[model samples]
Target: MRLAVIADVHGNLIALEAVLADIARFSPDLMVNLGDLVSGPFDPAGSAQAQMALGCPTLAGNHERGLTMNGANGLDALARPLLSPDQLGWIAALPATLTLLDGAVFACHGSPAGGDEEYLLEDMSTGRPRLDTEAAIRARLAGSGGAEMVLCGHSHVARMASIGGVLVLNPGSVGMPGYRAALPVPHVVEAGTPHARYALLERGPGGWSAQFHAVPYDVETAARQAERHGRPAIAHSVRTGWMPPA
Candidate 1:
């Protein structure tokens, strides 16, 4: 099986289109989206519509839950005008998790238990996220049985971890590449370059092998779009893939 996985497309259609164009060359058997789809300074409605047109399997991210559970938070404020009630409802109705290939693959926005909030493969005890220890990752998987592959997102960082014989993968951010986060603690996640990222998984006789890819897009144009949308911080991040110093 050849699967293409994308995640955290926080509403930048340019980057998303670029990444999707690249993925087409692979001619994947299946394409999966790990969510956080339309909650950014970019064209949220357009992004949501594009994803809807693709009809790829998806899981709801925390932003989706926030948009549905309450009319609060910065994301909801920015997203409301862009997405209609029906569109938002459609996104909210997405399941928090999904199992595919007859249990060969399990996917979630965060950990299996944490819904869309926790960082399954990152240790955040020190107020910043670092790759968690093997033991720590294993503990997060306590409720998740031995699935051959597990996919997750929400960290916006591309990573892969092998725990208990399962290949855990995060395809990272397809649109927004960097941002400063200030919940639970203050920290930043950066891809160190303005490139759209995703991952591919292939199953063969040996086992499942994973490959990460970064596709070039119009970073300057994206940054300008963010600025025009009144998101200068995000504009800076888009241009450099690193948050500007305070």
Candidate 2:
């Protein structure tokens, strides 16, 4: 089976469209979104609508919860007032995690127990991103069993880890590729290039093999859009996939 995975769109519809176009080339068996769909300096409403139109299984990221719960450490602020009450309610209703393919795959925004706030494969306590130890990842998956593959987002970093007979994957960001995070410790996550990203997974007889793809898009337009919204930081990241030099 061929599966296309997209995550952490963060409201840049331009990038999302580009990635989707590329994903179509392979004619995937299924396409799934791991969430953080809207909530960025770009068009949040449109981004949310685009993801919803796919009719695919989409998980709710922390921004969705924050938009509904008035928490999320203010991450949802810019996009919150832009959405209507109904839209906000819809986001609130989305599940944070799902066990799919009759337990052959587990999908989530973060760790199975992290609820969109934790990094499933990354340790952030050091003010930077690093792969979590196998033991640490196992601890995060204490109760998530029966899945040959696990999918998660929210780190905006494309990565994969095979441990304890499971392949854990993060497809990276389809919209915004980098951001300076504020939780656990203040640090940056950057792809080092202003391109959209996604992952393709194929279930082979042995297991799941993965491929990370970076799709080109109009970086300048996206950067200017963020600038118009008064977000220089996002503008910088949109252009170069790195935070503005302090």
Candidate 3:
């Protein structure tokens, strides 16, 4: 089965549309959104409506959880007013994780054990998201009940790692590619390209294999939208795939 995975949209309908159009040519058997759907400076309601129209299963991200928890925080708080009651409810109802392909694949916004906040394949000790050891990745998956493939987002960086023969894949971010955050430590996640990112996964006789795709879209438009929303930092990040100093 071919599955297309997208995550961390964070609004930006233009990027979402462009990515969807690009994915159409591949004609994937399944498409999944890894959530953080409408938590940004762009058109939150529009992005949410468009993603929901895709009719795919969505797993909640940290932003979604934040909104659901308190409805006040970061971009999610700013975007919440733009979304309808139903849209907010839909996002709130999304599951934190999903098991698919009859247990062949496991999907989550972050590490299986830590929900949407943990870094599954990243070691943040350096204050930036860098690849972690296979043993470390395996420990994060320990509570996940092993599968042939594990899919995750939240780091907003495209990466693949093998843990105990299980393939771990992160498709990266769809809308917001570069951003600085103070998590376990102050760090920045950058895709190093201003393109909508996603991943394609397929199961074959040998094993499960994955492909990462970066689709170019109207970055200028997304940037303008962010600027209009009074988020110049997000605008800079969207345009250059690099976070500007605050």
Selected candidate, larger TM-score, 2 vs 3: 3
Query: Each model's TM-score?
Result: 0.96, 0.95, 0.97
Mark the 10 consecutive residues where model 2 has the least summed lDDT: 66-75
Give me the overall lDDT of model 1.
0.86
Task: Supply candidate 2's per-residue lDDT for 218.
Answer: 94
Tens digit of lDDT per residue, candidate 3, span 35-139? 788999999999999988999989998899877766478897888889999998898888989998888788999988777889899998887788998788888
Candidate 1 residue lDDT tens string, 1-246: 999999999888889999999999999999999989888888889889889888889889888887786555786578867797878878978998888888889888898866688899887667556899998787776556667898999888899988878889999899888877776577777788889999999999999999999999998988898888888988888888877775
- State model 2's lDDT: 0.86
Residue clash pairs of candidate 3:
none
> lDDT of each structure?
0.86, 0.86, 0.88
Candidate 2 matches the true fold with a TM-score of 0.95
Highest TM-score among the candidates is held by which one?
3
Sliding window of 10 residues with minimal summed lDDT for model 3: 65-74
Backbone atom clashes (below 3 Å) for every candidate: 0, 0, 0
Clashes of 3: 0
List model 2 lDDT by residue over 137-210, tens digit each: 98787557878889999898899998888889999998887788778688788888898999999988977889
